[model samples]
Target chain A: MTLHIAVLVVLLGLFFVLPAYHVGAFSRIMVLAIYAMGYNLLFGYTGLLSLGHAMFFAAGMYGFGLTVNLFGFSVAPAFLTGIIAAAALALIVGYLALRTAGVAFMIVTLMFAQTVYLVILYFGEYTRGDEGFVVQQAQRSFAGIDLTGETERYFAALILFAICFLAVAKLVQMPFGKRLVAIRENEERARMLGYDAAKLKLHALIISGAVSGIAGATYGLLFGYVGASFSTVQYSIFPLLWVLLGGAGTTIGPLIGVIFMFYLIDISSGYTDAYLLIAGVALVLLTLFAPLGLVGTLRKRAFPWLP
Target chain B: MLASLEGAVISAILVLTAMGLSIVFGVMRVVNVAHGEFFMLGAVLAWVVTTTLGGHPVFGFVAALIVVPVLVGCIAAGADRLILKRVNYDPDRTIVATIGMLYIIQQATLMTYGPEARPVEAPFNTRLSLPWFEFGDEGFQMIWPWGLSITSYKLFVIFAAIAVLIALWIVLTRTKIGLIMRATQQDSDTAQAFGVPVGKVYSWVFGLGAGLAALGAVLVVPIQQAHYLMGGDPLLLAFIVVIIGGLGSLPGTVIAALLIGMSDGIISVFFSPTLAKIIATFLVAMVLVFRPQGLLGRAPS
Candidate 1:
């Protein structure tokens, strides 16, 4: 816990010391890291690998974006609506998807996500289809502070990230999180011990979805744009990649993974247009050499008490 | 009627692609997420061959039909040896590796193909009108319909797919390689003990699967334009077909492809294409949730 707080304190300190460009980049990474953290809860701890998490993220995004645009909702209510939308979606999807395990689960989630994406496209008049609508700068202010400003946006993102980070950290150390890990390690054994595996998984998915929704809502609110592109399979894969790279089941790993991937792409795009090629190669290499991921490898090799 | 014909063509292509995926999944127990990329590569390579040949369209098309699959098969085999073998084909790692391959392939194509949707000229295209039979006072006379017609190329696709399926059936059943492949699929450890080269068989199966997808793409490229992004739809549709048909069942795959392809075409006629896709995707997910073994697959022991 102290280590997590120290990490947050250092992040706060970095905002003041770092240059302008990095601070902005750090803000975006922090937001994305929250999404990764949410993904890790179900995937890392619960051992459910979903390929359609973009649906939840987009649920929050569209919920927030649509309510604000169509209904003239204030930021606070719009954000709540986004999170609720995601939670509701998670409830339905989790209930259905949890029926199938392993590869089928992956496929089910992937197809459901595809349906969400298509639905978004079908209602192009309202959602504006592929070309998404921008959240207006005028409506972005909350509590007498404009979120569009760089400093304000950074702080807003930081606050959200810190909250989620602490919650997930605390949750993982709790008995509930331990049970989830138990389920992950051995579902049959966990069930034999009288734990309701289905209900536990469903609850975990909802919480994970809500956290992802929070990130999604905050992302649109802070960055001031919501688009259907964020709902793509590519977007779904991003969290998986981040979680895998950062070390699944680790509290701070998602943040490290997000930052690592962000800079890898950012730095590579400067040299070539085919930056995704570099990412692909990195992924292949990681699977080959670092299957456990950075944090996972660290835990395995040294500092077993790190988590 | 037109929608059914179009669906038949789609089903034909889907049979080849989905069959490829099914075979690989059955034998290797690894889902190649890059399967669609291999299909895209086939279409792209077809374009390259046809354009560069600059001869008769038939000659170019024939050359592509013969050469593209072989080339793609070799590439897939190389990938299997390099990446898949190293990972030991663990299910999760295979997915990630294939996704990485997907990115590499897609990005490379974007860099080379330049993001344009390029069309390949069919070897031959002739519009053939059809007669409608109607009972009249003059007694059963065939009347020419105003709008009922199909191109020679579309009909050819249907025939080509049938020919390919027949040939594939024979290869899988009648040949020594087929026997080996079947043995490996049933029990790789036992087959290996019996002196079957399991590793080599895996590489060949991977190659064959990719080759089949490439062949499908080559055939369809003339009908639909070759584009870097065209693989996504086929991948999703093939996945749906594979799951609905029951994994690894050849006949099931063919039947499911027809069912799905026909519905996709007919649904588009009644509803918006996007709506059709949403419905299909949702229904397929429901099927997997309820009938995880698929429509024809035996329940796992």
Candidate 2:
């Protein structure tokens, strides 16, 4: 618990102070960590592999983008709208997808996500297609604060992440979280025990979707734009990688994975522009040998006395 | 008339890709997400051979039909032996590992070929017009003085795909190796206990599926051209086919492929392409909800 608190404090401090050291890299890492945590809840804890997480994430971005740019809504409402839109979308999609389990579920959800992506891509008149959406300076302010500025955006993102992290931590300790674990362990048994497996999965999906939505909304607000690329299949896989790399089923694992991946990519993009190859190799190795993930590995090593 | 032929041609192309995915999933129970990457590799290889080796494009195509699958098959076999075999039937880990493999293969291709799309020259480009077909001031016209017209390349694709399907059916049903593969699909442990070399059978099945995908790649190059990312689209389409066909059901896959292919082609022709995809995906999701086993798939035992 102390370790967790310490890590949280350090992360919060980094979010506030990192802009002084380096603006773009630090902010990017923070957003990615938040995104990974959302993914970790669904994949790591719930054992549901969602290949289309970017759909929810992009939903937030587009929701914020549309409300702010086209409808001229305030930033707070835009962010809330993005989260609501993503949650609603997740509810519908999850209701359908969670009906089936295993590979069928993964493919179905992914296809649905890809379908949305195609719609966004081809409906050029609305989405601007590949060109993407740009946010105006006037649109970036929340009351008196200028969100367009990096420091303000970073702080805004930090607040959202802190709230989401607390909510997830609390939820995971509740009875609902135990049911999720039961569902993950043995779906048939869970169903036989009178647990509404589908409903539980849907709950997790919605929570996962809501968190991802916030991440996406934050991304758009901070970056001051959104685009079709944000919702592509590549983006869908990003969270999965983070979950696996950091350690699925562990709270801190995803954050670690996201930070590591972000830094790795930032550094690698400078050298050969083949960050994907490196990431892929790392993922394969981790999946093969360290399936418990980084935190799981640490737990095993440090707690040799307990077991 | 030409529209019908066009539909037939497109259906044939989709079937080729779908069948390979079906076979791999059906036999090995490993969803080869990288299957489409093999197809892309085939197209790229054909282009390289034809352009560089100074041969007929058909010869290059044939070479790709053999070489690309063999190369990818070896990699897949290694993946199965080194990683997948350990995980066995654990779908979650297997899916993640395969996804990891997908990224590795995709990035490798990108690294080698770069991100730009490349074109492969078709061996034959001539259009074959039937004497019976004709069109007038009306929106449409038909046969016998306005009969059917088709591209020679499309006809070739249809013929090639049919031939491959026939060959696959024969291999799966008539051969001893095919029997072993069928047995393994039915029950891996029982097949092994019954003296089937389960390991070798898996490698062979993976190779066979990869080869079929490569064949699809070679056939479609004339129409779609070759590119690094060409595989991603087909991969998604194949996944839909597998789901609708029912897992491990070969005949079911064939029917599902035709259904989806025709639906996609016809719907896209009539409506916006984006709307067509959304509709198709929606239909699949509905089917999954109501009948998870698919059109012809038996209930999971």
Model 2 DockQ class: medium
- Clash pairs for candidate 2: B132-B145, B132-B146, B132-B147, B133-B146, B133-B147, B134-B146
Candidate 2's TM-score: 0.93
lDDT, candidates in the order shown: 0.93, 0.79
Over A1-307, each residue of candidate 1 has an lDDT whose tens digit, in order, gives: 9989998999899899999999999999999999999999999999999999999999999999999999999999999999999999999999999999988899999999989999999999999989999999988889899999999999999999999999999998998999999999999999999999999999999999999999899989999899999999999999999988999999988999999999999998998788888778877888888987899999999989878
True contacts kept of 2: 0.53
Model 2 chain B: weakest 10-residue lDDT segment is: B139-148
CAPRI docking class of candidate 1: high
Candidate 1: DockQ? 0.80
Model 2 lDDT, residue A16, Cα: 57
